[model samples]
Target: MFKVGDHVVYPYHGAGTIQDIEEKDILGEKLNYFVVFFPLNHVTLMLPENRVKTSGLRKIIQPKQIDELATALKPTESSTSKKDAARPYSKENETLLKSGDIMDAAMVISNLTSKEGERTNGLHMEDRKNLDRAKQFIVSELMLVNDLSEEEAYQFITDNSKGA
Candidate 1:
């Protein structure tokens, strides 16, 4: 269980800190909840304490793992053709996003970035949205793990995604 001030990622919602844990009575039953503040997204959530494990609430990746994440963003050869790479609104990509694992998120971003690079018309509407969401996930964790500003984190991901 995470304590106050712990940095954690809440799946598709991106990363945040555990600001507080409160117990409240509802329907005459008391339950504990975790108050998480997502600075990147300007959002807060009160997740049930009992649901943290099942809810995919996990601590942020360690600083050393950043190198591995950068590697994941690097361009790579793939068996699938560009046109079929990460098909519009792909379920596989969606699952990766929902996994709440930083490496999984990196893989999704890498695949989509490669697809975007291969396209002249750009990603379809759904694909574009997925790319944005995947980027946010990476950006959020990057900011926390590296103590970087939002712009810097974004640029870091963009630069690494380009394999530069």
Candidate 2:
């Protein structure tokens, strides 16, 4: 279980610190919750303590894993095909975004970016939205794990993804 001051990732919300754990009374029930504060989004969330696992909340990637994350961002042959066409509602990408896994986020970034390269008209509005969201997830974790500012984290991802 995460404690106050721990850096953790909440799926689709990026990384945040567990600011506090408190018991709250709602609907005549007293339940424990984690008060998570996401600096990137400037938002705080109250997550039920018991749902951490199912909610995909987990610790940030360690520093040693940074190299692995970089690898995942590198441009690669995308699995996206004409049938999938990198649609905004792609189930595979949606699942990756919700997994709260750094590598998974990287994969979405890679796939979407590559697909964008293959298109002349650019990404659809929703596809562009998904790409931005995936980038934010990576940026959030990088900011926490690498002690980076938001600008630095974004640049890091961009530079790494531009490589092979």
- What are the per-residue Cα lDDT tens digits for candidate 2 across 1-164? 78999999999999999999999998998999999999999999999987888988999999999999988898788667776664555667878898888898899888878888877788887678778999999999999999999999999889988836
Clashing pairs in 2: none
Best by lDDT: 2
Q: Scored by CA lDDT, what does every candidate get?
A: 0.86, 0.88
Model 1, span 42-77: residue lDDT tens: 999999898998999999999989899989988666
Superposed Cα deviation of residue 60, candidate 1 (Å): 0.5
**Candidate 1 vs. truth: CA RMSD?**
1.6
- Model 2, position 39: C-alpha lDDT score: 97
Among these predictions, the greatest TM-score belongs to 1
Candidate 2, residue 1: how far the Cα is off, in Å: 1.4
What is the overall TM-score of model 1 with all chains considered together?
0.93
Range of the 10 consecutive residues with the lowest summed lDDT in candidate 1: 81-90
What candidate 2 gets wrong by more than 4 Å, as runs, is: 78-89
